[model samples]
Target: MLDLPEDKILPGTTGPALQYVLVADEAFALHKHVMRPYPNKTLDIEKRTFNYRLSRARRYVECTFGILSNKWRVLHTAILVNPDFATEIVKTTCVLHNFVRRRDGLNCNDELLTSDLPTLPNCNTSRPSNAINTRDLFKKYFMEEGKLEWQHNFI
Candidate 1:
């Protein structure tokens, strides 16, 4: 690990100093950051920012885990045959969950499509296919109406 010079520790110079030290790496900033010493207050701010970004990033990860738990019941020990099969079971379960979710017609990134972001029904959990279809249609209608209003605003 290259120790940055005293001059490099100053504000506005850290990026260049870090880049110089980690010439080939895109994540020199991260390495430099982790290495740099700071007071408790500064460290607390960094920690808070890290936590906020982590929490935001992890929502998707949590959703994936939730999908796994709900779809395959991976939390159940019945799926585990042995230690060897455990890895395969986890992978297979994720694939199966995704496959079944798609097959059941849940569209990821489908906009709420309402003025105030309408409260969507928790239909993806488990409901009749027809119920899901009906929900989709209702949502689509509102989405179209919202789009029309949005267009009118722009025009």
Candidate 2:
């Protein structure tokens, strides 16, 4: 984490301090700065609704990864290069993806993006109560303040 000053606030926030967060899949851990979807078998309406919305949002991330891997064949196979160099290659491909999209109005061929990559089996871990509360807050926000008219269709 960057040693940003406590007073350096994120834009559009009331407080002076805020930590950046990563939205990830349930295969990853839920922490103070990481948000993930509720379990697949949740029956509660609130949890179900939250999962639907979060899944819709997460689709973009999944698509981007798919597109990146498809466009860069090296990403499709295990990189034999050093870890640092591999990271740079992925980063450079992302930059190039954006450049091509902007310059040529190119988009990912979604139909060709396959889901052949193996995913890690989700390991159930007891999450901290605070992380659950944060997720609840977001769920409430999406249900109320952040709701859109078409969102009802998904529910």
lDDT of 2 by residue, 85-128 (tens): 98799899999878877876765343447776578887677788
- In terms of TM-score, how similar is model 2 to the real structure? 0.73
Q: Pick the candidate with the highest TM-score.
A: 2
TM-score of each: 0.36, 0.73
- Per-residue CA lDDT of candidate 1, range 1-155, in tens? 44445523223222322222211111112232221111126434333333333344345655556556655556434554776698688888878867876877786543221122234442223334543343233223333431234322321
lDDT of each: 0.40, 0.72
The deviation in Å at residue 31 for candidate 2 is: 2.4
Worst 10 residues of 2 by lDDT: 2-11
Against the true structure, whose lDDT is highest? 2
How does candidate 2 score on lDDT? 0.72
Error of 1 at 71 (Å): 1.4
